[model samples]
Structure formats: structure tokens, C-alpha cells
Target: MIEQEQVLDALRAVYDPEIPINVVDLGLIYGVEITADGDVTVRMTMTAPQCPMSGYLLQQAEQGVRTVAGVRNVKVDLVFDPPWEPSMIKEDALKSAGILTDTPANPVEGDCSTEK
Candidate 1:
């Protein structure tokens, strides 16, 4: 059986062309499911709705995961239900990328919170 960690490791090999960070670190990967039959399904989203490199990114993700041992098939599903935001990026990655800010780069409108 293939482990989720292996799948994630493979994902770390793939990256968004626009950004230097990998998909996992960027928080583009939402969830990962591995079937008993060794099939892997990854739910992910793009940084933007109209990203020109979205297709290329998806193909890279699928191909990357497919290379993992014991993975019979790989499926990457693009979703936008919850949307992607800078706040979703891992804290460590944010600090490493030097993009960590006091507030989100794309904060929601009318969002007000004073809990610092």
C-alpha cells in the first residue's frame, strides 16, 4: 500500500511556475485520498481562477504522484469551492518565502478582526 506521506513527498516535487514554493507549501493541495487498490486522488486548487498555467500544473501534479511506488493511478481534481488564499500557506513556508505579512495579501472584504 502506498502511504500518504509518499504521495505528499511526490507533490513536493511539483511547483507552481509563478511561485518558487511547491504546491503543498503553497496550500494549493486541499486533500489526498488513497484507495485500497493503490489509486490516488488529490483535490487541489489554483492561486487564481484564470491562471494560465493551471493545466500545466495539474498535469505535473498527476504525473508526479503517478511516479510513486504502488500507485496504480493518479487523479487530480481541481476545485474552487473554498478558494485559495495566502493565509492558507504553511507558516514555515510563509516565513521561508519571505511573504509572511501582518495581514493576508488578499483579505476578504469587510473582514475585521482585532485579535493580535
Candidate 2:
């Protein structure tokens, strides 16, 4: 049987070319479900809906999940609800990247873009 941990571990190997952190640590992965038959589904989102790497990232994430020993099929679902924010990043990953010393309650007000 395939385990969620194995799926997650595989995704950790997939890095966002635009970001230094892997998809897992980037908090891009929303959830992972593995069927008894080894079909794995991953619900995830990018920093923004217009992210140019969307297709490539989805492919990378799916390929990564498929690398797991028992995964028969990998489906990467892209969602936008509740969107993504700087605070979504894993604590350790943020610290390592020198992005933050402590997680914030609200990192951004609206629109993840840096334009001000």
C-alpha cells in the first residue's frame, strides 16, 4: 500500500524553479490522498494563479509523486481558493531562506504580487 508520507517525500524532491524551496516546504501542497490501490491525488496551489510555471510545476509534481514505489496514478489538482501567501511557507524553510524569523499572522493583504 502507498502511504501519504512516501508521496510527500517524493514531492519534496520537486523544487519550484522560481523559488528555492520545494513544493512541500513552499506550502503549495494542500493535501494528499492515497487509495488502497496506490492511486495518489494531490491538491495544491501556486503562489499566484497567473504563475507562468503552473503547467511545468504541475508536471513536475505529478512526476515526483509517481516516483513513489506503489503509486499507480498521480493526479495533481490545482486550486485557488484561499490562495497562497508568504505565511504559507513552512517555518523551517522560511528561516533557512532568510525570509522570516517567525511566522506572521497575515503576510499579505491581497494579491501576492510585490507591486505597491
lDDT of candidates 1 onward, in order: 0.91, 0.89
Per-model TM against the reference = 0.82, 0.83
Model 2 regions lying over 4 Å from their true place:
101-116
Error of 2 at 34 (Å): 0.7
Report the lDDT tens digits of candidate 1 across residue range 7-104. 99999999888887899999999999999999999999999999999999999999999999999988999999698998888888777777676666
Cα lDDT tens digits, model 2, 6-59, are 898999999899888999999999999889998899999999999999999999
RMSD score of candidate 2 (Å): 7.2
What is candidate 1's CA lDDT for residue 23?
Answer: 97
In candidate 1, where is summed lDDT lowest over 10 consecutive residues?
A: 107-116
Compare the candidates by lDDT and give the number of the best one.
1
Cα RMSD (angstroms) for every candidate in the order listed: 6.4, 7.2
